[model samples]
Target: MAVNYPNGKKFLAESHMPKTTKKKDLIYSNRGMTLEEEINSSNEHYLSSGRAVIHKKPTPIQVVKVDYPKRSAAVIREAYYRQSSTTDYNGVYKGHYLDFEAKETKNKTSIPLSNFHEHQILHMKRCILQHGITFVLIRFSFFNRVFLLNSSYLIDFWEDTMNNGRKSIPLAFIEEKGIDVAYGFNPRLDYLDAVDKLLEHTNK
Candidate 1:
């Protein structure tokens, strides 16, 4: 059984691939969880503690073919994405519509704006227009720092790039504009604390 993209390219799962290592790419840290894994842990804690209701958005896939090798098992032979996904996650928080994207960068100086897409920035803008709380959780993997940046800043930088402005968001600018999220035990990344501060200022 095989899965494919809409463009007729065969899709391979990362878990099924052979692992390779690069000495330059290695980071010395006791906390080895990826940004997405940490967020998932936080979401679970939030859900169980009645703090928030957020979940990762599943990509829509359309299965074109399947094979029943056994009476109890069916394997998908072909599939394609139904459409481009909007964001990484979305749900309700503190009686407000929450929509956000989580990204991790190993760069020590700046996070490249290319980490974001035009459609995603537009989607965040649309969410804001609906009076929803939309933002990005940026993890600077090199420094082990996390920042919760509001969507407006992300949208502005994206537009600036269209005019041949800076290609990356400076760490200094992020430290100034975005709220820092401290790492913790139970939830791992305490991003909701940053969101609470944002709500305190904007109340939107």
Candidate 2:
């Protein structure tokens, strides 16, 4: 008599099983840290230093299946997102509501508008209507440059796209409209310095 498995393959000993690296683990090990990781670290630093109270919005996931190999351990085998998530980060800064989306692009010449979803743009617009400060932190990974772009500018281009305009925002336009955020040692991205400038301009 032979033992069988779910997929009609014989069960192998633990030592004979091939080792596999998770996609996120491979990304971290091979490409340093992702943009989200860097921003989360920066947010933690800001919170500890009393600079801001920002947090990453957790995406709700629906777990479909759980495998209980042992009574003490259970692993999720299947899951899906419950719904589309809003911006990456949101919180209160100096009594002002702050909301922002973070994105990275490898394209050297342009950042495509398609990278943004319709719901995200609408969320930013709604935030603005409520007098909340909204912006986007975009990184041009290839050039090792990061920028803080006001949501107003992003919305302008997004609306233009609806009118059948250009499909992407050129790097030149971004350089002109966006503020360059300095990469630093402590907070890492140092985007709040750029935010200060935006606040000053708005107040004036």
Candidate 3:
């Protein structure tokens, strides 16, 4: 299937990125699910439990070609995105607007800043000005560890990149500044737990 961006660039899904290591032996193991899938499951749990109502942002696409093998089975052969997306997920939590992006990296030491785009960062900045709770869910796939880093930290690092600063956020920096989100059976990734902690710290 051929998928293209609105600007005619080929769409490369994150799942298509090359894997460098086996994740089964890592801590907080994924059980073969991608980061996006795990977050989706957690969102479903949050919604069902009445804790939050967050959903992944869907990319609008224009189907260019489709093949129908059967009357009920149709396969999309080509498509184009209608516009660029701002963030991965957004909704409301406890009456606070929530907007966030999820990033996964096989690199154990750092997650590249390139995982985020300028337009996405701009959108997050605007949300922050509107008093929205904006943050990022970063997963180090090699270690199976996840952290919830506030968007302010991300934006600070992003702006530095334009001036020839480090291209990735070091794991040490994340460990010191971000909140650890435990992976569990029911919710998969308990990010809201970390979010509550972040809120408390901010309130103090």
lDDT values, one for every candidate: 0.83, 0.83, 0.85
TM per prediction: 0.82, 0.80, 0.79
Per-residue lDDT over 93-201 for candidate 2, one digit per residue giving the tens place of the 0 to 100 score: 9999999999999999989998899989999989999999999998999988888999998899999999998988888998998999997766877898999999998
Cα misplacement distance, residue 150 of candidate 2 (Å): 0.5
Roughly what TM-score does model 2 have, to 2 decimal places?
Answer: 0.80
- Model 3 agreement with the true structure over 1-204: per-residue lDDT tens digits: 564323322444556543322243244356678888788878888998999999998887899998655333355799998866589799998888989999999998899998999988999999989999999999999888999999999999999999999999999999999999998987888999999988888779
Per-candidate clashes, comma-separated: 0, 0, 0
- Candidate 3 residues lying further than 4 Å off, grouped into runs, are 1-29, 64-78
Which sections of candidate 1 miss by over 4 Å?
A: 1-30, 81-83
Predict model 2's lDDT versus the native.
0.83
**How far is 181's C-alpha from truth in model 3 (Å)?**
0.4
State which candidate, 1 or 2, has the greater TM-score.
Answer: 1
